[model samples]
Target: MDDQQNDAAGQAATRHAADRVLDAGALRALAHPLRVRIYDILSQYGPQTASTLAEHLGESSGSTSYHLRALARHALIQECADRGSGRERWWERPVGGVSFTRPAGARTPSERSATQLVMSEFFRHRQDRLLDFVMHSEEAEEDDWSKGAMVSTATARLTPEQLEELSGRIMAIIDETVDRHRDQKGERVRPVSIRADLFPLATLEESS
Candidate 1:
């Protein structure tokens, strides 16, 4: 099968494979705004030291190190085998990426509460990232990346199952695109942050 056909055939199976589950502790650990920012930086920039992350985020190295250790304790990140020594440790996410949903095997309302915190942070980070691009994209666009930077919004009426399928398909398409350029030799290949927001309008907020 060609790449397109392969993606179509494996879409159902591959979507879940790319995302690992988070437990209550892990969810809570990542709910902080700074922790979320640190995770995003590491995921996008590859392995990073606490010092580098601190510099990028304008945080103190001590603060970054504390958060990095917390993320590691929950297995959200790990030490890089090929980089760093002594105090300048490096960190990266696991080979399998993580997804934000209800915690796996959560039994209590308290566990679900952690999920809420994580969900809140998720929305905050998503908005901040889009805002960053919008606020400063003029300088970046001069380098020929403007076409890829955009906010796409669409509304649709569908059942929850349909929404789930749509989410899977969107992620599958993204996976296919990333895998295509992941290993090939290229000069201008740059990281592109993509976000998808799909939901019905009627229930955008919780009922009182």
Candidate 2:
């Protein structure tokens, strides 16, 4: 399939084979805004040392190091044993989809708050990235990529069951494509973000 089609399909499939639903403790660990940012960086840019992450985040290495350790405590991230050494250990987000949905029986106020914080931070990060891309897409458009790059939105009405079935099929195609090219690397290969937002719109009465 083409890049645009593939990206649209992949984004539609938010849950995947690598998805991991967060438990209460993991949600709490990831609730902090700084930790969420750190996790996002690792997810997007691959492995990095505390120093590099701090530099990119405009925070002190010490501050980033503390958050990294906290994240590691809950296994949200882990050491890259093959890279870095000593105090400058490399850290990476384990390859998986982190589902922020609270686990069953985790309805305590604290757990709910944690889940909200993490989800908010996660969406904020995604929005910021998308905005950044929009601001810079003109530069990219000058190249061959413009043909496949697009920004689009649409609305539809569907029953709950239909939505579930549609999303499942989208994800199945995405999974097959991703599994085949998960490790692709070459001179022309670059990381691309796939984004699709499929959710119910608030009704007029609900908005009021």
Candidate 3:
């Protein structure tokens, strides 16, 4: 087998071995903004000390350490054996990926509110990062950059069934593409954010 095939197979194996579901408590624990940020950092850079995480997030060491412990409590992350002096602890995300889902039991009003708050904060954080990138691109060449730009919005005439099928296809395409390129490594290539958003159009009556 080729190098690409070997890498793909290895990733598939790792993904299969990883946990695919998060309990409500685990999801709630991971929903915190600081914890999410720390997870993203660790996923990109591997294990890191709390001090290092604090420096990267511009947070106090105490605050970062607290959040790290909360994440550990939920099994979202774990202490790594490789680092830390006598007192400090280094950590890494334990699972290959985290999947969020509504639990089996009906959610209480408070639980529903908590879930909404968590999702809202997560998306707001993502939107802020996208806005920051656009705002900071003043020095970038317009013509050169325009070639790499994309802005697409469409309103399709389709039944609900068709819409559902389309959504599933789109998600599958995204998953495949992300999995394909996830393990590529080189000095010239670095991490790039690829965000996808999909939702049904709101009716005029609903808007009014």
Question: Compared with the true structure, what per-residue lDDT tens digits does model 3 show for residues 25-74?
Answer: 87678767788788777776678888999899999999999999998998
User: How do the residues 1-208 of candidate 2 rate in per-residue lDDT, one tens digit apiece?
Assistant: 5676656555656556457878789888888999999998888778989899989999999999999999999999999979887867999988666675643346788998888788788889898978988898888777766667778987779989767656765666656666677678889777677665667778999999
- State the weakest 10-residue window (summed lDDT) of model 3: 97-106
Query: Model 2: what TM-score?
Result: 0.83
Candidate 3: C-alpha lDDT: 0.70
Give the lDDT of residue 198 in candidate 1.
78
Off by over 4 Å in 1: 1-14, 102-106, 137-143, 159-162, 182-187, 203-208
TM-score of each: 0.78, 0.83, 0.72
Give candidate 3 regions above 4 Å deviation.
1-21, 43-47, 80-89, 94-106, 142-149
lDDT of 1 at 95: 66
Pick the TM-score winner: 2
lDDT by residue for model 1 over 110-198, one digit each (tens)?
Answer: 77777776677767877887888888878777656776566776677888977776776777777777677654455887667777677
Best candidate, lDDT-wise? Answer: 2
User: Which regions of candidate 2 fall more than 4 Å away from where they truly are?
Assistant: 1-18, 102-106
Task: Name every residue pair that clashes in candidate 1.
Answer: none
